[model samples]
Structures are given as structure tokens and as C-alpha cells.
Target: MQLTVFFDPKFLAIMSNRLQNKKSHKILFLDNTLDVGGQEKLLYDFLSRIDRGRFDAVICCLKRGGYLKDAFKKLGFGFYEELLSHKYDALAYRKVSRILAKEKVDLIHSFIHPNTVFFSHMAMLTRSVKAWVLAIHASGSPAGGRLIGRFQKLFLSRVSRYVALADAHKRYLVDVEGLPEKKIDVINNGVDVDKFHPGPSDPDFKKGLGISEGEQVVTTVASLNRRKRIDLLLQSASIVLEKRRHVRFLIVGGGPERNRLEHLTRYFGIEKNVTFTGIRDDTPAILRASDLFVLASMRGTETFPLVLLEAMASGLPVVSTDVGSVRELVVDGESAIVVPPENAEALAQAIEILLTNEEKARVFGMKGREVAVERFTLDQMSIRMERLYEHVLSRSRRAD
Candidate 1:
């Protein structure tokens, strides 16, 4: 068991140990929680698919372990749930130190903010580890656009290496966070295309939601939050109804903003056309049942959303704001329409184009699916990460 501090790329040390070259190294990943966000999905998917023969993995989540944690365990992976007492728990430090010693962790991967600081602090003091790797989720930065930027930048600089979600993230690491280019890797968030691809709606989706056969349904599956801009969704849906009557909206997630968003729908007089299904596990089927998929988010927070890839894999053309790395995946006309965030008129018009032209929509959906299958597959992400782990472990041994 080797416990270490923040990662060092150029590390080469003299040591006294009989280290084998091919033994599977153990890794510990500390994620803030197991919520159903795109970043959480990326972390969980990596935990599930990484090569077990080359690496032994254990995940210790701070709190709120979702169904995916159990799903990981079902696949024979080890997990430690709800170890943190609270968001700023002092006891968490001691508890994590014990787990590190007991598990004999070789490397620590920190996902989200503060966890990097906490883990790096522990590892530096303990002097028993090899490296600390930080996974930078886009939302962890200052999409809110104010004092949060200062905090985000401070937190980013404390890590060993930054694993970015997209190329935009890597750029921010270099320009904003001042991290070296070699210290950042832009590993785009990937989905399990086989699982997220088009599926027959559970035979009950329409029945449960009272969606009739001839209704034009559009679904957006994201946390009900300010960044998601559910109000913009409702505003656009109102515009969509002017061109085509009887268009229905299906919102398939819940959060703090659900009540406000619901009120906004009524305020816009399109309450009758919208249905808030709350948080749901049947995302692929819900997306499959939709005539179109939309994601209306501001730029900084929504870099490479997993739902966009899922929508593409489900053969649905997307209409999203040109935010973050969205332009990297969604071509203006080829894959999906890219609109400016908060522009109700543009959003509505883009969605209407896809809805009105079935032939073009089908072509875009097919092209998006091809991109998802070829570039954003879970297997490809796992393979890249497996090689990363092998490299990390090999370097760790050489440093000894």
C-alpha cells in the first residue's frame, strides 16, 4: 500500500522495494456523490468498464449513492458509500485516511472540487501514496459567472493533473487555471451507446404519461436547475405551439428548480402542453419516445452533456444552445441545431425545423448516431482510461 500526495508528472524517485511489473495496481476514486448528472454517469461508467485484470478499483463516494453504485457492485466492483459526515466534515479526513491504509490504495482519483484538496492534503501528509488525479466536471467551474470564478480557479490549481471533460475544459485549465498543457487530458464524456440507444418504449411510457399517438412530444432529461434553463424550454415550447398545434413537452428530471419551472409553464400559458415527470431512470426509453430532444443550457456549465450523446444514440436530433463543447459534437445542420442560450425565438425555430422536416431530421439523427457509436462509446472511453492507469502505475513503480 503506497499513499502519496498531489500527482507529479516528472516523478522519478529512488526506493527500496521489490516491485513487480505486471501486478494489477489498486486505485481509489473519491467522488463527491453518486447523483445522476452527466459527470456522475461518466465516473460510474468508468468504474464499471475499466479493465479489471490490469487494475483493482474501489470507489468511495461522499454521499447520496444512486442505483448505479449498486449496479457497479452487482458487476463485482468494490464501493464505499456515504463516508463523509457532511459537505465540510472534519471527521471525513480521518475516516478517509483509515480507508486508504486499510485498502492499500496505490493512487487516488478525485472527482469534483474540494475532494481534490482534501485527498491531496491527506496524501501529502501521509507520504504513502503515488499520485492524486483530479477529474474536472464543467459545472464545478463558474458558470454562474461571478465570485464563483475565483473559488473555482483556486480549487483547480491544487490537483496533480486535471482530467478535463472536453477540449474547452483543457483550454480553461491552461488559460484560466494556469495548468501546464501536458498536465491536462481532454477525455470527453461518453455514454454506453448499447444501453442508451433507441429502445421500444416500455409499452407503458405513453400510457403512463397520457401521451396520445398523434402528439408531437419533445423530451429534455436534465436536472431541474437554473443552468438547464427550464424557463427557456417553456418559452420555446410556447413558440413551437404557434406553428404546430397539440405539441406536448415531456420534462424527465427533478431538482430545486422544478416548482419554479412548473410555475413558468403556467405563466407562459403552455402548462397544458407540458408534463413534468420528475427524476426518472427510463431515460433511453423516454428519449426514444420523443419526436425531438432539446437541451437549453448556458455555455460554461454544459460541456459535453451525456444526455446529448444519449439523445443522438437514441436517434433523436438535438437542439441545444451553443455552449461549452456543444459545437464540438452538434454541427449546426448536420447533427443538430445549435442556438444561442436564452433565445426563445431561436430555440423554437431550430426545434421547428427538425420537427417540420422528417427526412432531414432522420438524416441528422442517423449521422449523430454514427458519431456517437464511433467516437463516444463507453468501451472507447474505458480503453483510453485503462491505458492511462497502466501508464500511471508503471510510472509510480519507476518513481520508487
Candidate 2:
């Protein structure tokens, strides 16, 4: 018997080259707008902290200018804007396809609706891109009503991977959209703990908001939309004030519903107690000045709210509605006080409980901070995403 050992020379050479020259993977991110929202903020955070040696990032938005445009440019990443005037623009789609091919993007990660639908199809059209990842940040039907919702379900099947902001979102994708459960992955939004840690309250911030020295400030940072239920929050503020008149409410965000919400404050006769600080840039400072955080969102609108994490990281106890995986984010009695949505009385009661017990509130804040640092940090999220990219790339290569 003759012992023969044979190895393919081409295979050996390819392996040697791969080890010697590790090529950095190029990733492209697509979004409808770079507005100052949770999804956009998370994208900025991921790109800013992602490992530069292993991956390069590029961003393209459907709408041209947004608050985060300058921030992305400061990160030394290329940014492109392809404005889509209509719902279905064939020219815009072609332009995006060309961009993906020209950039040699290995992976295309798209967030939210039309971006997810558009880029996934574009990846198929380009043929050069290895994978397309779709991320769903909100847990509800697609925007633009039912027809667009149907289109989303139809297009979502074409993407190579799906990421949900929370498990509740994953279930929605499966049950409502008929997506396979195995195709979806749940990755909660994370915050930069170091940037949002507990610290001395900013006196200037409080002064600007007209918060008195003895008044306890309750702050909420969210877009002022009907879905956010700012009306209910106003009612809750009125309820809280009836018992404790020294508390103040700070509503920080700008949207079409601002006028209505402001009117509701007047209607409830809590105008003196409620301050509408429309769209401030210094969120961490505002959160630090706050003694408590509340989010009274409507049911089924939220997935995993980033503001809650920011508040937790800021060492403030939260009182949020039990909507879309919020219970998963906060332990009812331990980290936050979870209450039912659309119930102003319940919301006010939860706020009063925290306000009455200073020691218990302090303990909850400390525990929340610990949870945020351990479970939801920028570094941890980046590492998980890096691994996910590598896994997708490996699978694509094997298929090739």
C-alpha cells in the first residue's frame, strides 16, 4: 500500500493570502432620514464606535439634510443623499443600485421601511453585494397605511437577514408579516453609559427650563406625536400636581403635535407646571437635571425605546407604559415602574410612588444604572454587530 497525501495548490495559496492580507469589509447603511430619532441615533452610535480596522462604513439617506448629517461627516465616513420625491421612484432606485456597485459594499444594512424594501431589492439588482440586512426599530404596521404595509410584508421576504429592536417586534414580523421566526434576530438598542452616567444636575439647564430649586423635575424626551400620548402625560401631570404642587414637567421634542400638546397643558390648567422645551440638543444635561423620567406612549407603538435606556444610564428611575418589550427593558418594581398605556391615573400614581419614597427611588436609579452599564452599552452592541457581520460574510462566502 502506498500512502498518498494531496492538497490543492490553489486552495493553499488562497488560504495563505487570506491570512496575510485581511481585507476590511465595506458596509453601507441606508435610511429614509438622518433625523434625530432613536433609529438614526443608534445608527450613528454604531458607526462611530464600530471597529475601523475590520470594517469601513458609508451612509446614504433618501432625504438630503438632517440634524445628524454633520455628525456623520465628523466621523470621517462618506455620506450620500438620494432624494425620492415620490413613493416609487424608479430613477432613485437605479441611482442607489449604482452607488452600491461603485462603492463595492460587501453588506447593505437598511433601517426602517422603504429603505429596507428599497435596498434589499437593490442588493439583488447589484449582484455584487453579499448580503442585505433589514432592521425594524418600531413595532407596528408600516407607515403610509395598509397598502404600504402589504408591500412591506411582500418585500421583507427577499432580505438576507432581519433585525428587530426587541423580541416583541420579532413576534410582530412573524405573526403579522408571515416571516419565518428563524430569520429574525432581536438586538436591543444601547446607549453610551459613560456619556450618560449619573452626575451633578446642570444648574444652567434647570434655570433655562425655569425649574425652581425646590421643584422636582419630571422629564420626557420623545417626538410630540399623537402616538406618544403627550395628552395623557399632560393629564398625568395635572393629577400629580393636585397632590404635590412642587413638581415640574419638561417635555423635550419638536413635532406637529407640539401645539396640541401645549394646548392640552393649558386645558388641564397645568401650564405653570409643564414646560415645552422643543428639541434641545443637550439631552444628557436635561436628563441629569431631571429627577424622574416618564414615557406614556400609546400601546403597540414602541419596540425598545432608547430614551428609556438613556434615562436609566443617567441614573434616573423610569415610569413608562407597558408597550412593546418595555417590560423586558425594565423590571417592573426594580428598575422602573411599568404602568398600562392610555391610563393617566395609573401613570400619575406610579410617578407619585417614586416621588414619595426618595430612598426607594434612589435605589431604583442605582439599579437601573447598573443594568444599563452591564447589558446595554455602545461597546457591547458594536461587538455583537461585528460578530454578526462576520457571520453573514462567512455564510455568503460558503454559498459562493
Candidate 3:
């Protein structure tokens, strides 16, 4: 993450008391939580590679900071947790504003829904911050319903700029949510290719997961949530197993929908062929030990999933529901077999097609790895993001 914190010279001159005479402009990265999720991991990766000479970076979790707290701490970035206790926490907002003022933060880059809403309101309340950027990682309502969605949009209308992970999502924000089209930047998700690449399948790892030798592995790494549609994947897995018995399905990650998904696997009478690994830190290793990757997310939910980038980086042929910016990520027939969401037959057919044809699957995997390297590397994403931050900062200067 290149901090590239820019502020208006006039504001700096007028607010001399609050503004500091420092070489590096401070930035505050806000999020709802520090849970082991894609957003948090993305932030971690950005911070790990941040250009410290250009700007100072800090993170504040509005709610709870779970799992990744120590990881962030080890990276030497300042981390704050439990800044907001409830929805209507006026004092907490004031505290956050004070922190912004004291830090002399030049920018506030917030992620996802509730945190974006909170920071949007905070941007209105504080003068210390120059730019407010909110990245929309998913589509649909803002979680509570039309009422909350309206409130969120109303608050975010005043933000400095918006980061949409895909052009499809950028259109949705302008068309459905009535946000300014020019304010949205479509920056695709990226992965660390060095960490995830073509490698030999680990026989020991497969055996530990109850996968027998010579059994092909089809894996999906996602939170076991309804929007992720892990149940639909299980249904397709059942169909695939009826014809292809020498295959193992690994449903990675844990969420509220775990028990129901497990029950569904049993209901399909394919319990022996499926394994739920809950959550694991060794995702790169797991990806290397798999034959294929699949994502059955529901329509209008996911947007430029980082897991897909990871899978592509790992040189695995993909089978994904045509949702969000999947088309932008992988060529339909070259790198992956795109299928409609909630269609088990299509998913099963695509899975079977890839598994049956080793040469085709290998070619797809090779193409996916090529795309990952050529288009979606961490350095490429960071450079683009740095430029956006600079643009937003420069625009803020002109506006002031």
C-alpha cells in the first residue's frame, strides 16, 4: 500500500493548529472487524508491503478485532480495536473524530458496509482528514434492508471517492445506488503469485484430509455462508460423485451455515466423499494440493473474489457461477468453465468435463496461471491503488 497521502495546502495553512509539519501524511484504514476474512487479509497484505517512506498507516476496528490482531501487530502497524460499541454510539464517533484530529490523518480508506457508513459520517464531522475512500467488496443491500441501505447511501454520498473492485460493480453502484459514476474506481483484486503457484500435489496433505490416493480433489475456499452457496456446491458434488466416484470435495472455511451444509452433505448421502476443513491458514499449500477449484456463489453477491485470484495463481482450472466480475477475471472457456448460479446440473457438468479431460484441465490451469501473473499481481494492484489515492488527494486539494 503506497500511502500517497495528499492534502490541500490551503487547509494545511488555515488549520495550522491541527496539521503537523511532517514529511509523511498519516492515513487511517478503517474496517468493521479484524476477522479472518478476505477484506482483512487484503488489508494485511497491503500493509505488509506498504511504502513507509511516503506515508504513515494505522488501522482502527470499529467493532471487534479478532484473529488478525496479533498478525497486524507483528507487522508494526498501529492497531486500535473496539472503537465503536453499538450502532448509535455518539461518544464513540466523537472518540474516532478526536483520534483523526490528533493523528492529523490525511486520508481515511474504509472497507465494506457498516464501517464505510461510519467513516462517511465521520468524514462529515472531522476536518483533519482530507479524503474519504470507501471500497465496496460485495453487492446487494447494506445488510439491514432498504432503510439501512438508504441511510448508508445517504452518508456515503459525501465521501471523497469510491473503489469498486470490478466494472460490473461500478455500474451497479451508479445505476442501482445512484452514486456518482466518475467517483468510482474499478480496481480488480490481486494475489501474491509467489505464494500461490503450480506445485506438486502433497500426498501427505491429501491423506490427512481423508482423501485417498489417486482421488482427484475439487476445492472451494469460502466462508460457509448462504450467499457463498456452499449447499449448492454440495448438491453438485453429489451429482458429480454419482458418476465419478474417485473424487474428493473439500469445503474450506467456517461460518453460520456450517451445520446446515454438513447436514445437506449427509442428506445427499455423499458424506464420505466430502470434508469440511473449517478455516485453515495454509491456503497456498491447500490450493497446491488440489486438482481443481470451484466457486458457487449466488448471483449479485460476490464481487471480484480474491480467492479466485489465489486459485488462478495456484494454476488450478476453475468452475465458478457467473456472478460479480468473474468474467473479467477468467475467460469463460480458456481459464474456467462459467456456470449460472444455483444451477447444480451446470456446475456438475462443468466439474465433470474438467475432471474427465486431464489435458484440457491442464491447459486451463496453465492459462489461469498466465492470467494471474500477467494481470492480477499484488504489485500491479498496489501501484494502481497508490495512484488512486494520489488522485483523490489531489482532487481534495482542488475542492478545498
Ranked candidates (TM-score, high to low): 2, 3, 1
Candidate 3: residue 18 Cα off by (Å): 21
User: On residues 266-380, what C-alpha lDDT tens digit does candidate 2 reach at each position?
Assistant: 8989999999999887899999999999999987678889999999999999999988789877888998999988899999999999999999889999999999998888888
Report lDDT per candidate: 0.76, 0.83, 0.84
Worst 10 residues of 2 by lDDT: 140-149
RMSD of 1: 7.8
Candidate 2, which segments miss by more than 4 Å at Cα?
A: 1-20, 141-148
Give one digit per residue, the lDDT tens place, for model 3 in 296-346. Answer: 998766778899999999999999999878999999999999999889999
- Candidate 3 global Cα RMSD: 6.5
- 129-191 in candidate 1: lDDT tens per residue? 677677766643334442124544554443456677778767866776566898777777777
Q: How accurate locally is residue 148 in candidate 1, as Cα lDDT from 0 to 100?
A: 24
Better lDDT candidate (1, 3): 3
Quote each prediction's TM-score: 0.88, 0.91, 0.90
Where does candidate 1 stray beyond 4 Å?
1-22, 64-69, 139-160, 199-204
